[model samples]
Structures are given as structure tokens and as C-alpha cells.
Target: MDQPGLATAATQLCGISHPVFQAGMAGIACPELAAAVSETGGLGHLGALRLPPAALARQIAETRALTDRPFGINLVHRGGPAMFEHLLAIAIKARPRAISLFYGDFARVIPRIRAAGIVAMVQVGSVAEARKAVADGADMLIAQGVEAGGHLRGQVGLMALVPAVVDVAGGRPVLAAGAITDPRVVRAALALGAAGVWCGTVFAAARESNAHPAYRQRLVEADTDMPRYRRGLSYGWPWGTPHRAIPGRGGLNPWRLMGGGLRRGDKSALAGRLSLYAGQGVGQIHDSLPAAEIVARLVAGLRTGSDSPPSPQGQEA
Candidate 1:
């Protein structure tokens, strides 16, 4: 067997040249980005959280049209009562290389996914979740830390969570996420027992992603101490759910003072006003290159050991 630190199960499962995975960012994930990453020899992903059935089918078809390589879809399990059923139907039709589930049980869905010959990858934030996911038949596990940009499940940081999940996974592949931007972090994740690293903020500024120009600019310019923002009016996704992003003046305290407005309910607010999701790794984002370029840069960095300096506090990029 290959060394635990080296790329092994991750490459085999996704059939990609590298173990790097483009973490599926909802609203930002697009077919162009997915296909571009896949073309660059990494696993790309499409977020299927908010899409309707027909829209999901169209997105899959569009992605297929862009690249012949394998790609994955990310499904948020707690979206609605019929989410799983809708996802299962879409998975069967799309026949993707892999389907990743977050914040849900995989027991009932894993068999159906396997029956369709699709790999079932589960994202978990704790050791217990990892063990349960493996026993429930997950092909791979994503260890997400609190420093991650989006909704997170645990307070553990990546340095500790990766190894814990790896130990609990019992030989199943584990992908470490949160604050992963540089190649050194990727190497560290591998050394810590993860088969790969899933990066969301690193690619949020990618050219192919659907993030707004202002949002992309913020990622390139934001600093590490940017106050992470969240609203109670939207979805009560647990208080103190740390989201690292470029904090605005007055921090996010003003948002709280405003009683956590329903700004997310308005689509137009997503471009710049609402909380722009990002990770501490945003400091490493220097350019808004294409997905292929981003993958190539990561692969190159891993090979050459290049590391970008951390950004100043309170800055965005």
C-alpha cells in the first residue's frame, strides 16, 4: 500500500491525477468550474443544494458537455424533506463519479448510490461522525473544521480534526478541509493522514466560479481577522458557527445590532452586501485565475514548495 501521506485512495476513487478536491461552494459552484478542475486532473464538484430537479439535470448535462472526466456533486442533506429523494433521482440520472452528502445520514442513501455505481462521499466534522459515516458505507470522508467558510459542525481546527477523522474512518479515505490554501497545508494534511485536501476559499476567487466580482476581489484582498458573519433570521444553523471572511467596518457586530436581517432572502444582496463567505486562506489568493490554472498552481506549489505569506490583519486580500 502507498504511504498514508501520499495520494492513494483519493486519486483512485475520483480517477483524478491529484488528490486535491475543489470544495463544493453553493451558489458559486458552476459547471464551468467543475469541468475545468476535472480537466486539470483534480476532482471538481457542483453544489446541488438549491437547484430544482430540472435545473440540476441541466447543470449536470452542461458539465458533461464541458468535460469527459469524472466530477462530483455536493448535496446538503438537511435542505428539505424531499431533498434526498430528489438528489437520489438526480444522481441516478447524472451518473456522476461521486456524490457527497453533508449534514445527514448516509445509511439509507448509500445503498441506492452504490446500486447506481456512484461513489458515496460523506462530510463530517467530528470523529464520531467519521466512524458512523464509514460504518454507514461512505466511500470517503471530508473532515471539515470550524475555520471553513460555510456552515461548519465542529469547533476543532484542521490540524487536529484531520488526524482524528482519519483514525475514526478505519481505512476509508479522508479529505481535510478548512484554512487550506497553500501547498504546505496540503502536504500537512497528507502527513496528518488525510488522502487529500478539499479547498473552498482557495478557489472561491477562481475565474470560473460564479462568485460576484466584488466577492472575488474581497477574497484577493481580505485579511485573516475579518469578522465572520452569520444571521439568525436566515437559518438557525447553530450560533457561533465561525465563518472566516473579510470583515466589514464595525465588524459583523452591526449586523447583529440590526437584529440579523433577512438580507440573504434577497438574491441581489448576495453580490456584495450580504456576508461573503471565505476562509482564513483567503490571504493566499493572489489572482482570479481559471479553475484549471488554480489546480495547476496547487500542483506546482506542492512540487516546488512555494508558500505565500499571510495577509495583514483586517485586510481582505
Candidate 2:
């Protein structure tokens, strides 16, 4: 396995060259970053969160121009029905190779996507959810563990969740997400029956990501056991969704200043106050590099366990 070929079903189901996935990280997974991953023989995904309709269209067009390889976009299905409709229209117009939905009535949405001849996948945190998704005509399932960054739906760890989901899925392809930045972890997930790996925090720290400088730097310097939190930042974001991220430390106070979000003035400034979402696997990220290099390193890491330290060009890890 020196070349670490695609040994999982994800490569064929998703029409990609590798079994690695770049998690759609909302405002962070920009077009350049997504395209970079696609160019490197892995599936790239644009995070379709908080982006305007026109902006989302532009992002899709831009990414398409970069690479003709099949890619995807992630959309949150838990929002208002009206919002979902509007976003769904935009998504159908973009015509991505695949669409992954999280946190909503996927049963209802899957049909609409299938009508458009698009492969639809659901991100689920439990075996029940996985079973429901497959029954509802989902093409694939992403088993998201609690260690995932951003909004998480359940409390199961990747170590225990993958096999259970796989068993319940009953031959349906399952991708394991959450804290899978390490190559060894990738190998383990595959061993546990995952066909691929969904990664976010590490990609957010990549050079092509749109993460704020402070946020990216925080990920690099973070620890695996640095008292992680399961609450989302209470700035202007919806209050009920649970997210796993590192609290601000050092000079970076990630907590919004008291009454800071009250000012609707500069939305840009408002975005800066929110905490950086990170998975426990962040400790494995030592340097920020291009998306392709990151994918290569992860793939190589899965193929060969090099004892050398990670270099700026992450492929050497």
C-alpha cells in the first residue's frame, strides 16, 4: 500500500480519486480551497453557509472554472423551510456533483435533490439517523462524531460510532467525520468500516481557507486536551446548536465582548468576535499549507507512517 490507493467505496460513489473529503466549513471553505482539493484527486466541498445567493452562485462558478472534477457543497437543512427552499433553488442551479445535508428533515429534501439527478448524502451522528437517511434514498451517509468542529448533532466518539453506523447502514457507504486529521486515524476509520474521512478544522487552517489569521493560528498552537467546549459562540449565531471548539486563549479573547454583537454596524467586525471552531485533532496540524499538499500529506500518512516531523509543505508528514 505504498501508493495508498483508494481502498474504499467512497472514491467510486463520490466519483473522486481519493477517499478523503474536505468538510464544507461554512465561511471558511472558499472556492480556491475546494478546487485545490479536487485538483489533488480528492473530493472538494464548498461550505454553503451564510453566503448570499449571488455569492454562492459565484463560488460555484469559480470552483467549476478551476477544475472539471466532480465536487460538492454542504447545506444545512435545519433552517427555516423558506430558507431551505431558496438555498435549494440555488444549489440546483449550481448542479454540484453531490449535496450533503445536515440537521434537518433529510427525508423530505432527498427527493428534491434526487429529482435533479444529484447524489445526496446526509450527515448523521447516530445509527438511527444513518438508517433513516439510507431509507429515505440518500446516496451516502457521513457519520459525524462529536469531535467534529462547528455544529455537532450527537455525542458519540469516532472510535465507537463508525462501525455502529456502518452496521446499521447495511452496505450503504459511510464516511467518518470529526477529528480525522491524522493519517493513522484515517486508517482506523477505514478499518472501522468508513469508506472515507470528512475533515474540517485542518482544512480551515490551510492557506487557501478563508479563516481569520487569529483563528488559523489558534488551531496550530492548540492542544488535544485543552479543555474543549461543546457550546456554540453566543454572538449573533443561533443559540441552540451545539459546536465543539477551543475557547480563546492568550491575547485572543474569542468570546464576544459584552454587548459587542449588539452593534449591527460592521458585520465583518462581528464575525471576528466569534470563537474559532476546532476539533481535538487540531493538535495534529502543525503548519498551514495548500489544500492539495494537505490532502497529499494525509494520503501519504495513511500509506506510510513516516516518523519525521511535519514540514511546511505538509506532504512530508
Candidate 3:
């Protein structure tokens, strides 16, 4: 099939060729993966959660080295305003195309991001939050549904949440997240008034991603029911935050796996025990491919029918 020419408000605002976006999933969404997606005409995002200042700077530099296309970095408000300020400062210095914020009231930092000529994208789960984000001067908004992987913010599903967010976005572009794995879901997001789609689970399995080989294989072998969402599935961050991940080998308790000095990004035996954060759409992915190919597939999905994307800008949570 011919690749779709998806030039919507999102693509226009983000200065990208297509509206497809690879979600910045922490641990798995690395610089290599982001650059590959950006190279393929989609907007790629580097995950910056919990990274030290120097590390975040290096990743930004690395992504820039790979591709000159517009890309963004995902930031969370977990570390308090002071911590967010420090991360934001590093991102501003890099001058990326956009900076996506989530998890807390980022209103205070939005102006600074925009002042640096970076697009301030906020991820929200509810209509109220969407309104707040828009009022806070966000250039765009991401509507996250509960079906999404990683730390979730929405209690509603994608089908109902997209339109609700769109209604309160006040003309800002709204990208739909959660269970966004295939072309069908992409089309649905557009139909529901989203300017584009922000995806995580599918991209996590890409060859360029930082996901472990076994984790990538598990995604290929998984079905919709394979992933389970629970509070405190892994260490770090505030307690009671829900995240979805496939159980480790033998279904060991995630907390127990986190013990024994298992460092983050472990690819050995420790890797097998850590939960593979993924969305409910795991069943739709059957193979591991390059990040460019994954972007191609989603871009093709935008042309599955005669549907056209709405005029608006976009985000991920």
C-alpha cells in the first residue's frame, strides 16, 4: 500500500511529515528509537524521566546526531517543581521542537518552555485536566486512556476519552493514547476528533528501542490479555500509580524482582524479572521490526479509508 500523506495540524505544528508519534516510554523509548521514527517522517520523543541532567543532555545530543527532524522529550512532574525545573532547563538548552509534560501541575513551567521556542505539550486523562492544560498555555494536549502502558492517568478508555478531551481542548490538537497499536486504532482516533495518535506499546517492540531482546519477543508472543495493570508494579515514582506490564518469568512479584540490587535497564537475569511495560494492544503486534517500518505501518493506517485528520497540534503522557 502507498504511504499516506498525513499533513494535519499536528504535523504542521510539530514540523513533521506525518502525524504519527512514538510515545516516550521510559526505559524502552531511547534516543536511537526516537531518531529512527523521526527519520521516517513521524515525530519521535525521547523519554527523560528520572534521567540525570548530564544523561538527559547526552541523549538529546545523541538524538540530534542521528536526525535533524523535529523531535521531542517526555518529562514527568514526579520530582516536584524544583526537579521539573531542572529537567526543563536542560531541555530548554537543547532547544528541541517540543517538550511533553505529564503527572502534575506543569502550568508554572509551560511559559518557560514556550519562551525557549519549544512547544509545550501536556498529557491529561480527563476533560477537566484537558481544560486545565489548555488554560495553562499548552500548545497541545495528549488524551491518555487507561489501556495505555506505563504510568496511566486516565480512568476512561480510548473510545470515550478522545472525544471528551477534544471537546475541551479549545481547538488545540489532541492526540489519543492507550491501546494504539494498529492501523485500525489510528483511524479510530482520527474519527474521534484526534489530530493524530501517540503510541507506546507497539513502538516498544521496535528493533531500535531499548527494550530487552526477551521483552521484545514477549510482546510479539503476547495477546491482549497478557498484560496486567496494577499499582506499584515496579519501583520508583509515587506509590499507587498504576502501570501495565506483562508478568516476568514465572510471574515473580515485581517488588521482589526490584530487590537484590537489580539496577534499571538490566538485560541479564534481572531483566527477565522486571515487568515489560506495554499496553493492551500487545496482541496486535506479531513481529519485531525497525522503528522506521513501524512508523510506516502507522502512516499507512492513516490512509486506511478516506478519513482526514483534523486541524490541531498533539502529545503523550
Candidate 4:
């Protein structure tokens, strides 16, 4: 937790020791995973997109019990204004270190978040979105490149998108998101002017994540090109919006058969049909490790070979 050399303004803003942020993969990132990362000095996040009020509150309490260190909750604003407001109310009452928001307009809610003494973070896909988030009074911005897994926010790749967003961040810490699967990539993100990194795919396979065993196996077996970005047709989500997922046998994903009916921790065969959301860097990840070890390896590159990398067998150190 005393990794001062790896600290960035973004990490400082979140009060975490390292600049690694575990992406709030809705229905995937669990309290255990978030707590482990936070305890290890990186920022862990509870994905609150699919949770009910009671579940979200319970998760907040569970995370608190696991670690006294700071953690955050992630909510998707585009889900619905009323639901967003309801979740925001719960988040403000629970008062996590920060709340990271994605999709829709952040301006309408950043004020209340800041007023509640919570750091406001917005994830944007394009430079225009970055400017809007900055103007909306966001404390931090996550530049999500098209190479990222799950729902894509921007069509630009990480290499071209990060610096552009950084330039327009209005001095707010900007975190690079996409295929941040290894420490070397983390270092490259910093070189691109990103204050930190927000990672999702790699962490979704963490030992403690809520990702089903089938999904984890798919990630381990996946190649860089296995994931394909397609319109959100199966889910009850808007048809125009695109999301990335690894196809199952015969290039078919079971999620296409169910619409908004899946829940986390469901161990049935239907659980195997859950969309395997992952980044292009899935090839580099081959094993499930503790969230803390993953955090250690991700920050190891910041030392520039001065320190030995974490000894995780399946992943690139």
C-alpha cells in the first residue's frame, strides 16, 4: 500500500495508493473483488448498475466489513433517470470514497455528488464527452477506447483517444481504459498522458469477481480477436448502442436468448450463457488470480524493471 512511486493525481483524488482502478463491470465485479483490490491499495469498485437498493446497500456494507480502505460504486446514468436518482441517493447516504458514472448526461448529477462530498468520475468515449464531463464538474474522467470490452463509449482506439481526452480534461485526472491487461500497458497509458488506468476485462476474471466460471474460462481461452462488438440486441437495452462480447460455440452468445433476465451468481446452465465481456487484451490473461496480486502486477511496470514482477503464472507480468 506504500507504493508512492506509482501514485498519480487520479489515485490521489481517489485516496488510493496506486493508479489502478478496477472497472465496475456490472453483474461481474463483486464486493469481495472490490474489497481485495482496495485492501491492496488500488481502487476497487462495486458495480451498482443491476442491483436493487437493498442489494446495493448490502454490498456497500459488505465491502465496508471486508476493508476499511476507500472504495467506490459505479452506476450507469443512462439506465433511467429515476433509477439513477434512487441509486445516487443510496450511494450518497452510504458515502463511498467516490462514485464513477457512465453513459447519459453527467452534468445533471455531478453537482449533487460533489455537494455530498463524494468525488465524481465520469467515463467518456470521445473528446467531446470529455469536455462535457469536465464542464459538468467531474473530479475525474475515464477515457474509454473502442478496444475496451463490454459497452464501448467511443469508436476511437485507446492509443488515439487517451491523449486527446487528456488535453481536454480541464486538469481533472484522466484514466485510460481499454485493454489495460498488463503492467506494461499501464505504463504505456501513463506515457500517453493518462493520470491512471481503469481496467475491466482482466479484473472480471479475478478470483473473487462475480463472473461465472464459464465466462472466466472463455476469457482464459480467448484470443485478442475473439470478442466482437455488436449492437445490444438481446438485452432490453437500446438497439443502437453497441457492446462487446465473446461468442460461444458456433459464434452464438446465449445472452441473445434472454433479455435482462440474467442475474449475478446464478449457477444454472443459463449462467453459462451470460455474455463474456472482455477487452482485446484477453490473450494476455490466462488465469484467475487474487485481485490484490493482479493489482501488484499491474503497477509493477511503473518501477521500470527496478522491482521483480508479481509471480502470477498464467498472466504476463
Candidate 5:
């Protein structure tokens, strides 16, 4: 069987051979994982949200050292305008193939990215956000549904959100994200007019990822009961936005525990108790294979129908 022909905006925007993208997962995304995906003909993303300017530069350099293939940098949009300027400065120096922005406006940075000959991709969780991103000159729009892990902006599921964003984007390319762990979903995204798919949880278990062993194991052992709300963990995100993750022992339901009366002390306590950070698709993950191997399997899975269940082996802590 041949790989499914599911091309979208990613192909034209970033020159990636495949429409599959490795979402920029904070803490786990690194040069090794990004470069490996790029080498395998998919778009790889490096999360620069927590890195200092110097560290971001070093990571970009490191990725370049591994492969000259096209890769992108993810910038959390809420980090203020200065963060954009700083990221732009580094992007100018690194000259990445693409730059993805999420959780903030892209008006100021889009032009700079385009001026630097880099494609600008914006991640949007709502129809309003998608239209705004297009108006702001984003070359590609990632329609991230609420089913996605990490910081979600709205409650729309991928099945409905992808088509909505695609319609709002006009002629622009749209990438579908959220709980897309199966090839059939990949096919569905394309059918919904998405040019590609951006996956985060699928690669969290990759060997090149920096996720803690315990975290990876939790993802593998995840069940339908795994929590995917923001109130469970504390990472200074006061927005109370919903995020997906596997719930561990001592995990408190932010809603039930806080009971709408949150205090500074409560925030502190919750931060320490909850594991925080992960996607609902965690249950689909099985092992910590090399980035290359993960990509190969995804490509293979798309090409041939494999009845074998996903491996349940857990990585060592």
C-alpha cells in the first residue's frame, strides 16, 4: 500500500513533503526530535515559548546541524509583543522555513516572518480566531480543536472545528489539530478541506522527546478517564483554559476542589499536586521509539492497514 495522498497548505507554505506536522510540545520538543521529523519529509516544530533568546538560537542552530530540512519555531502569542520581537530577531538570524504563532495576535509578526522569507502559520481555536489570523496575513492556519492537549482556547471539537475554519479561511490553507491519532482521522481532516494535520501527543513518546519517563508511561497507560481540563494543574496560566492530560494520584479536580473560590494558596497547592500537561490522545501512545521510527510507523500505518494494536510497552523511568 502507498501512503495516502493527503496534501494541504503545509506543502506550499513550508515545502514539507508530507502534511503531517509535529506540534511544538513544550518541554518535549527539541532539536533532535524536530530534525528527525524534518528529515523524514514532515514539518517539525520547536517550541520556543520557555527558552531564552540565546537558548532559542542554540536550538535552531542545533537543529540545522542535524538536518538542513525545513523546520519551524512555535511562539506562544500571549507572551507579549516583546516576545514576538525577540523571536523575530532569532528567526531572522536562524531563517527557519516557517514560524507558528498561537494564543495571541499575529499582525505585528506576520509581516516580519514573511519579510524574512519564512512562512507564517497561526494556530486558532475558534472561527473568529481563524478569520483574524487570515486577516493578519497568516500563510497557513492551524485549527486546533478542544480535543487537543495543552492550552485550548475554546470548546469546539476537531470534527466540527476543522470544516468551520476551512470555510472561514477563504482560500488559505488550514491544518487540523486535536485528538487526531488515527489515519482515518487524517483522511477525514483532508476530506474536511484541511491541507494537513498537526499532531502533538503522537510524538510525545518519541525517543528524542525530553518528556520524563514517568510522564511517557502515564500517557501509555492512559484511559478514557484521563483528565483534560486546565484546573487540575498550575503552570501560571491563570486563564482557566482547558487542557488535556493523564490524571495521576493526588490529582484534584480543579473545579470540585476549588469550588469557584480560588486563592493564591489554592493555586500553589494545586500546582504541586497535579502532574499537569499532556493530551487526551495519550492513550494512543505506546512506547518511546526514536523520532525517525515514529514517523516511519505513522507513514506505514497510513499506507497499510495494520490490525496489530498499538504496543503497550512503557519507557523506563
Candidate 6:
């Protein structure tokens, strides 16, 4: 098959060849994985959630050393100027090709990102948020739908969220994030006016990903019941955020896994207990290939046809 023919405002502005933006998933989404994708022509992003300033800087340097291709970092805004300023300083110091913001006061952060000459992309789930992001000066808007994995705040479905965000974007590049793991999903997003597609599940299974061996195995064997969103549990930090993830160890019942969040103690002791997050499209993921190979297939699949991804070798949740 021929290469997928996609070139969006996002691709041009970010200097990437394709309109594929890898989601900055916390934990497993690291420098190696990000660099691998960037090398293959897709925008790579580091998920720098809760990383201390020093560690953040180190990871940025490492990723830079890996690839000269454009790459960005994601800082999940925790609703405070201090938080924004802290992460912004680290990112600016690293000087990435772009910076993606999520759930924070854009009015306070967008200016700084722009001032630094770095492209700014904001991920939003609602039209109101999209309007606010643009008004605050977002260079790109990523429309996230309800079926997405990770910590989701609202319930707007992907189909409904994309057009609304596009309408509010006023021509700025808009990438669709959420349950978009198949070629059909990618085609649908492009059809709905999205400038590109942001994917997590597919890349999370890449060989370069830092996911634990067990976690990697789960992704390959993932059926429908793979992801389990942490709803009302706040284990002190990003816990109570209702983030979606892979089921707990041994495929145990979700609620029985970490029901009340982290059990009191060393904190890190229960770290491995968290669910391995994948989108609602988990069953579509069935292999552990190199990041470059995965990107190639995705680009090819998207360019081929929207007739459901190559027969999935997975089962239902």
C-alpha cells in the first residue's frame, strides 16, 4: 500500500511529515518511545506528569539526544500558576518543538509558550474549553472524546466532541484524541474535520515503550475488558482523576484491585498495582512491534481504507 496522505496545519507548523501526534501517556510513554515515533515522521511527546524539575530536564535531554526530529512535552496542568510556571520553565529550558497543555488555566500558560517561540497545543473535551483555549492563544487544539483512556473529566463522545471543537477552533489545527486506534477511526476523525489523530494505545504497545513485560503481554492479549478507569479513588495524587488503564495484575477483578486507591504506606509500594491504561480500542491492539514499525503500519492503514483495522486477534472485555 502507498503511504497515508495526510498533511495538516499541525504537521506543517510542527515540522512533522504526518498528522499523527502520539499522546504523552504517563509512566510508560517515555523518551525512547517518543523519539522512535518522531524518527518515523510523527510528532512525539513526553508525558511529564508529576515529574520533578530535575528528572524532567534529564528526560528532555535524553530524548533530544535520541532524535533530531521535532518532539514536545506534555504537562498536565494541575490548576495552579505555580504548577504551570514550574513545568513551563523546564520545557522552555529544554526548548522542544512544541508543548501540549491539558486541563489548566491557558490564559496563564499560553502566552509563555508562545513567547518562547514554541508551538502550543491544548487538549480539550468540550466546546467551551476549545473556545477558551483559542481565545487564550492555543496554536493547536486536540479534541478528546469520552471513550479515551486515562483520566477523563467529562462524558462527551468523540464524534460529538470533534466537530464542536473544530467549530470553536476557528481554523486552528485540531487533532482528535480518544478511542481512535483503527484506520476507520482515523478516517472518521479526518472526515470530522480533525487536522490529525492522536493515539496512545497503539504506541503504548510499541517495543520501545517502557511498559512492564507483564503490561506489554496484557496489551497483546487485551480483549474488551482490558482497561479499567479509576473513578473515585484519590491515592494522594493523580489517583482520583478517573484515569482509564489496563486491568490490574493477573486480570483480577478491577474493584478488588486498588478499590480505595493506594493503601497507606511507601506509596511506591502500590505503584505496580495501578491498571495498565489503554483506550476503549484495546482489543484492536494485538502485537508488540518496534515503534517505527507501528507508526509505518498506522500510517499505511490510515491511507489504505477505513474498513476496520486488520482483523484484531483479541477478545471482548
Candidate of highest lDDT: 4
Clashing pairs in 1: 220-317, 221-316, 221-317, 222-315, 222-316, 222-317, 223-315, 223-316, 226-247
Order by lDDT, highest first: 4, 3, 2, 6, 1, 5
Superposed by TM-score, candidate 3 places the C-alpha of residue 208 at a distance from the truth, in angstroms, of: 0.4
lDDT by residue (184-286, candidate 3, tens digit) is 7788889899999899888888889887777777788889997777776356666667777776665545533331112235656755676667789888887
lDDT of 5: 0.72
Question: Which parts of model 5 have CA positions greater than 4 angstroms off?
Answer: 1-7, 251-273, 301-317
lDDT of 6 by residue, 227-255 (tens): 76667553324555666666455455553
The lDDT values for all models are 0.73, 0.77, 0.80, 0.82, 0.72, 0.76
Cα lDDT of model 2 by residue, 212-280, tens digit: 666676677777874255554443357656777665433555453211111113344433454557788
| Sliding window of 10 residues with minimal summed lDDT for model 5 | 256-265
Off by over 4 Å in 1: 1-7, 227-245, 248-272, 305-317
lDDT score, candidate 3, position 201: 80
Q: Kindly report which residue stretches of model 2 are placed more than 4 angstroms away from their true locations once superposed.
A: 1-4, 232-236, 250-273, 305-317
TM-score of each: 0.85, 0.88, 0.90, 0.91, 0.84, 0.86
Residue pairs clashing, model 2: none
Query: Candidate 4, residue 91: CA error in Å?
Result: 0.4
**Model 3: how far residue 297 lies from native, Å:** 0.7
Please give the lDDT score for candidate 3: 0.80
Clashing pairs for predicted structure model 5, backbone only: 8-195
Total backbone clashes of model 4?
A: 0
In model 4, residue pairs whose N, Cα or C atoms come closer than 3 Å (at least 3 residues apart or on different chains), thus clashing, are none
Note the clash tally of each candidate.
9, 0, 1, 0, 1, 10
Question: Between the candidate structures 1 and 3, which one is better when assessed by TM-score?
Answer: 3
Cα lDDT for residue 227, candidate 3:
77
The worst-scoring run of ten residues by lDDT in candidate 2 lies at 257-266
lDDT of 5 by residue, 129-165 (tens): 9989988898899999888877787789888999999
